[model samples]
Target chain A: MNHLFFQINPLEGFFFGSGKAMVVAGVAIIILIGLGLWLFRMESRLQRLNDALDQRLNDAQNQPS
Target chain B: MIQRSWKIGGLALLGYVLCMIFFVPLGPGLLEFTSTGSAGHVQDQDRKVTVYALTGFGTHWTESPDQLTVVLRHGTQLASLPLIETLDATHVLVGMDLPYTVPSKSWDVLVTHPVDGTLLLENGVFLQDRFIDEQTKWANPEIAEYPAELPFHFPYQPQILETIRNLMLHVPMWFTMFLLMGISFVASIRQLSTAHDLHQDTKAEASVQIGLLFGALGLVTGSLWARYTWGAWWVDDPQLNGALVTVLVYAGYLVLRATIQNIRLRARLSSVYNLFAFVILIILLMVLPRFSESLHPGKGGNPGFNSYDLDSSLRAVFYPAVLGWMMLGTWMYHVRLKASSIERKLRQLQ
Candidate 1:
């Protein structure tokens, strides 16, 4: 884990001094992360809905109505 | 098919914008020009003065020194100066002969290159004058024309530099947020008119959720950009404060909804609150920013990129970016609305 962290040092220097290009990269990354979180939240909601419907279906079948 | 096309189209447009943002180069700009000696000023009696200039981004001064045209501009008059030497691609030594009389003490330096177009340093040199002369003849009079058919490139802004490309990402976030908020506002109005229709309420809630996401992203990105350019993570600008407050107000709408136990009451009360929130949003974002001094472009005393800064090159990618982000936001709202409707139906069934 320590070695893995050190690998980023070279890249960090380039990004930090690259005529403020790092700022653009930062903006793009923030957007990607935000959208990715929303996607995951949507997925989890659908998952919960699926589980609830399946449970209800099981209950209805067992009742023999 | 149409539904799928829009989603795919929006993604493709954003992909195109992403490619252009990183690859498109920035044009050259004059960063600083200073007199080589004697307190960085030229006296009226001084016949010859040497000046050194430092340029930023895409400048090729040494490639063809002869192609470079240096001029001192005072008001409408342009007096051409000879380029004494090219130290490197970014540094140049220029010799200027002091005119006997001039319109004003302040002179703007214009360096026109065949490749870099025309780079200007405002008030590049100052002259020590005993008296002001309104009528003066320029020794070397030449009008510089910017080269035609230059390649597509973002205009080099001194403070912005390469980060100027953030215009594509940062600006579109707010545009997308506005679109979602507008949708939510309309849905809230419909919910109120229909006497608290649950479906309309769901639509309003979903749109606000997505709008808030975009608004949060906008603030974060704007803050990062400000940190790099303005040397601060957060400034007390009206536009920035207004955006933060608007996002918080919508967040309050969510909290208000979550607190209410009764479904009908929640819909009715939140719809009324949404109306007021949108009005506050308009006043803070559009009206107040213009009235007060703001560091953000297009507000207060600052002229926006629209007046001149946003060139054809930027407009090419920027418009597509705004459209793409709007489409993506609408798609997210659609997903949220569908999920919420399903959850509500399941609750009712139980």
Candidate 2:
């Protein structure tokens, strides 16, 4: 195996073999980050929308419908 | 309603779990059998065949007066077998009978060993297709195309494997964002027709909120994917650019909503402004990147690289991610409504 490396390129082995593992890990990280941010931002938006609506309604009632 | 919610949620969970159970593919796509000796390919009909009755690891052959029977088969097609004689301790001498001829084509030839009364080989010989022409003693040699690619094969078909776990999270962000923006679009439209529909305003507000959720998610997931795949937090790709533009447009929607206070004017102008933004959103995210090529999955003349992106193992988890995120989005929307109603009740009390 050592002698095979001396004759051939190191990227050749990784490009074919363990390179697959790299792609798998790389894509997984991408997906993970997307999901986490989605959850967090959605959560905050839901809260903000409710608060803003309450303030608007309060201001409306104070002026009389 | 609370009890029903629990039951419905339980049933959905059960159904999802059951779908995962049918994941195992069961069929005769693959088969294996053990035999006393290695199976040999059928060269032709006239070739003398031997059967060994095994005593141990090696078979002990006996010469019998009974005529050796041979059955030649090409898949289901049965052909006449050559007559053979049982000679010596092991070998049978087959006599070339009735002009021994067989079409050169890969066939699952079935040859039975007489001694053990067992199938010798299921796939005895694989032959190449070459019709033997009578005019030429040799097979009619057509100029065959030099076998282009040896055979289509997989060289580590590298794609999102467990990366599919990201689907649950990454893909859902877009789903949520799309859902929220869609509602906002509807609310703005409704406000135009129904002069003073506060409900529409409420919906519009809710929609932008959810859109923000999705936009943020898309960015995080995309950035994460960029880091892992491209070894950077960001890159200038068409699809990514379009997604960024869509998020920015939604952010602008929020800014526009906050700046105006006249409910009637806000509803009318915000609605008009939102309509334009969504039109731009569709053009930028849905249209432009598609005309140009994109690193994102679905773009370019290429239908996109998702053939291997989603495997069953990942699909098992991905569907749940979508459901969970969607349910969570609905939950948020519902809470917003509740808060709206509570405020209404409190005002009536006042």
The number of the candidate with the highest DockQ is 1
* TM-score for each model: 0.82, 0.49
For model 1, residues B208-259, the per-residue Cα lDDT tens digits are 9999999999999899889867989999988889999999999999999999
Model 1 residue-pair collision total: 0
Which CAPRI level is candidate 1? incorrect
Tens-digit per-residue lDDT, B205-279, candidate 2:
776776787788778987986665566788888877878888888788778878997767877888898889888
TM-scores of the candidates, chain A only: 0.56, 0.52
Q: Mind giving the per-residue lDDT tens digits that candidate 2 earns over A1-65?
A: 12232223344335334445456445544554464455446546756765777787688779875
Where model 2 places Cα greater than 4 Å from the true spot, the runs are A1-65, B2-162, B301-308, B340-350
User: What lDDT does candidate 2 reach at residue B97?
Assistant: 27
The lDDT leader among the candidates is 1
